[model samples]
Target: MSRIVILAEGSFQFHAAKTAVGVIRYSKDTVVAVIDSTKAGQDVAQALQTNFGIGIPIVRDIREALPYQPDTLLIGIAPRGGNLPAAWRWQLLTAIEAGMNIVSGLHFFLSDDEELRQAAEKHGVMLYDVRRPPEKKVVANYTPHRAGSHTILAVGSDCSTGKMTTMLELEQTARQRGLNSAFVATGQTGIMISGNGLPIDHIICDFLAGMVEEMVLDFCEKYDWVFVEGQGALNHPGYSPVTLGLLHGTLPDAMIFCHIAGATTIDGYQHCPLPSLPEMIRMNEDAVNWLHPHHNSKVVGISLLTHHLSEAEAHAEIQRIEQETGLPTVDVLRFGADPLVDAIQRYFNA
Candidate 1:
């Protein structure tokens, strides 16, 4: 396993640097340090206000993180378009010069970049682009794959709304209950954590659903319960296609709607307001029905992201959402995924 140093730089919040947070929380590799100038000289868990990376230190740059002897540098900045920021070039160069391999999940592949490529070649380091799609072509056949398997997909109100986190937590809780389960990663962060999954967003648009369907078929054949990770948002102007593709591809028997507790608009695109919980639920259900009329998939639960709320406030919000949606709901990371998992178990049992 690679000894890693995460480069979050200017973006190092729990919600902002999800790639950083996910790696810190779930990766098997050792994350020696995080490069965040703003939060330098602080504990990663303390800086992110989470209990994941307890002793991991936050430093100002690659040079500072070098003392930890990290052979790999992870670019954990998740921008709107996944573009490589101009300011981060020097940091990558510095890491490459120090003979550290670079790993990035951005759409902008560093290996394809001429300057970074030449520099990496000179230093004998590799550039691993996690989001690059496979060369093999695939297209959707829309074959229903849920004969003896249970497939669950997490749909979100907006991007970075905790779909991956919710599904991961749910999978962990399900395994403890002695159920045969698998977490099907769909994003780069999830792929990095699980070490095997196609980046749903990076796949070609025409082949998106087919690739997802292909993956789901493989997993359903092995695991009785397949929890496919979600991407983007169904109602989002920027990322709706990938969500739609994943929904159709996975053919989920049930979906858990994910949303940040007080969010009224799409993050980053604040001009686009979010729909009510009920309306969003209806939208996803209708979408599934439109694609596969015979499939009985519906939004079975709500995964509320209440990290922004206090404990008392979070409980109140969870209660309110449960009352509002008339479905089991909980903040997966904060309160555990028992409620949502129970709801799924109840649905399948009945």
Candidate 2:
């Protein structure tokens, strides 16, 4: 049977540990052990029993856990400002040396760490950052035909909070406006759709740069509107950095930022502390400043993905953000299609 080990730092004890356990269980592979020095000697089985109800021992050190000879190692160590911790790096290197495949969610794994990536490549060990899937094969000859009055609306958040659903809703909303819109999966979880009767390639792999340019050009030429979704979490490789980078030179006429106001989003903002609200606000402002100035693009509006907030609470949050940023905000669920179209029209007209 295949076996896997999990290593996590103190910072990732709660969420990362839980995620690691789920991956192991879903893989149908035996979980050899969990290594958390702070929680050493504690029964991994009992510690995780509350969450997973499965018994697995928690060991103090990698050496102690190695006797089981795991086939894979999942690292759940917290990133140090987007970089891997030295201890975690050492652990990964050791695991690779031991001939175990490594998978991690650390952002540094997607960085310019040639040594780390090359070492794993040399060992023929697969490393999945979990933020972005490995690149896939692209179709070389596929080219999208230009359509008249077609506008591709691409909306992305700084993170991964309800991006998929929001994009889908935007598609439906566009259809109500008598405009043809389809969802394109630029990231790992996005759906594939045909454009102008041609099968569009996956955004992340095939035509990331080309698609952005082509879509923008197509929007200028053919379709009424196109809606592209953005994710919430910035640390993930499949998030907006790449998409935004591709849009640097060729930006759409307008863009919308989606903000989620739910329990998950609140917890993500508060406890998880991936990207704080203030930081995100500042980031969006910066992005707007750059695009608005350089590319002559405008921030059309902001959409609230209210999964849990009451109408009053949601409006209050939107009001606060609008007052601070001086930008119009629309509660996607409450405003329906008219407000969205108005926002799009106002910005495009400006």
- In order of appearance, the predictions have TM-scores of 0.95, 0.46
lDDT of candidate 1 vs native?
0.90
Which one wins on lDDT?
A: 1
- lDDT of candidate 1 over 1-350, digit per residue (tens): 99999999888997788899998888889999999999999989889777778899999999899999999999887887889999899999999999999999999999999999999999999999999999977898877675778999999899888899998999999999999999999989998888889987778889998999999999998898999899998899988988998888887888999999999999878899999999999899888888767766788999998877899999999999999999888998888899999999988888
Q: Which ten residues in a row have the lowest lDDT in candidate 1?
A: 288-297
lDDT of 2 at 80: 40
Error of 2 at 143 (Å): 14
User: In candidate 2, what are the lDDT values of residues 1-350, reduced to their tens digit?
Assistant: 45878786563243445345434433345777888777776765566544452567777767777897888777644454546776667777777777788765555553247777787788887776544433443322323325333233344444534444455556677777676655444433242111121112223534454545554455444455655545333333444455454444234445565666543333344544345444554554465446446434555566776536677887788788777656677666566645656777666565
Q: Model 1 misses residue 150 by how many Å? A: 0.8
